[model samples]
Target: MVFHLFGLRALEVWLYSRLIRSPIFHQMVGRVHRRVEQIRHGIPPEESRTKLEGSGSLDKFVRYFKEEIQDQMKGKPRNKL
Candidate 1:
């Protein structure tokens, strides 16, 4: 639930950026996604890969939720220094 909230927040922010015509915001969103992919691949944390083998929507949602939350929290806000 928390993770979904985080991803939803990010999606909202990105949509807002698109409305505002900010290329920078789009770039920020891309960076966030890349970080999530890196985490899932265990680039730094070195987590073992698990194969779910064609799971349901809930399974996909949970994994995506976790990755989005982790990525967003670690990312720097666009207006920050």
Candidate 2:
């Protein structure tokens, strides 16, 4: 999700709420899908992949909840979750 769709070559910020059913759809139909479309329209590639070596959205959420718990334990902000 991060590398190809939002590598440094593409926009940094995106609307996370907009979920698509397929990477193929984004590659085919999205605005500025140059990286994906050009190859299919021009030349066939021998390899396709999405890298799985990265922290996911669930990892972020877990980190948040853990920090919130730690903050409450430390009596920070005077609010509990």
Candidate 3:
């Protein structure tokens, strides 16, 4: 049975909110978050060596990755990932 918003009770909302905040939910979310981050990023470095960002963190990473790839293709010889 679906409970419409207008007819929902306080107890229902309270229970739902509690379940959302539970540690189990957080752990599942953390796993998904890490997997997604790894996919978007090539791999997790042992230690990140980065300077302070000025509003273009993702753009900088993308550009640097692309440049490194292009340099390798041109036989410039860079770090092997």
- List per-prediction Cα lDDT, in the order shown: 0.76, 0.62, 0.79
> Please, what are the lDDT tens digits per residue for candidate 1 over residues 1-81?
999999999999998877779877777887788789888886664443565557686688799778777778989434323
Error of 3 at 7 (Å): 4.5
Score residue 18 of candidate 1 by CA lDDT.
Answer: 76
Question: Which candidate has the highest lDDT of all?
Answer: 3
**What's the true lDDT of residue 42 in model 3?**
66
| Superior by TM-score: candidate 1 or candidate 2 | 1
Give the runs in model 1 whose Cα sits over 4 Å from its true position: 1-20, 43-81
Clashing pairs in 2: none
lDDT digits (tens) for residues 1-81 of candidate 2: 668765744443333323355576576665456547766688544354554446785687789889888888988844544
Cα TM-score of candidate 3: 0.39
User: How close to the true structure is residue 63 of candidate 2, measured as C-alpha lDDT?
Assistant: 93
| Superior by lDDT: candidate 1 or candidate 2 | 1
Clashing pairs in 1: none
Candidate 2 overall lDDT versus native: 0.62
**Taking the tens digit of each residue's C-alpha lDDT, what string does model 3 give over 3-75?**
6654577678898899898999998997888778888996773443576466588788789989998998999
Sliding window of 10 residues with minimal summed lDDT for model 1: 44-53
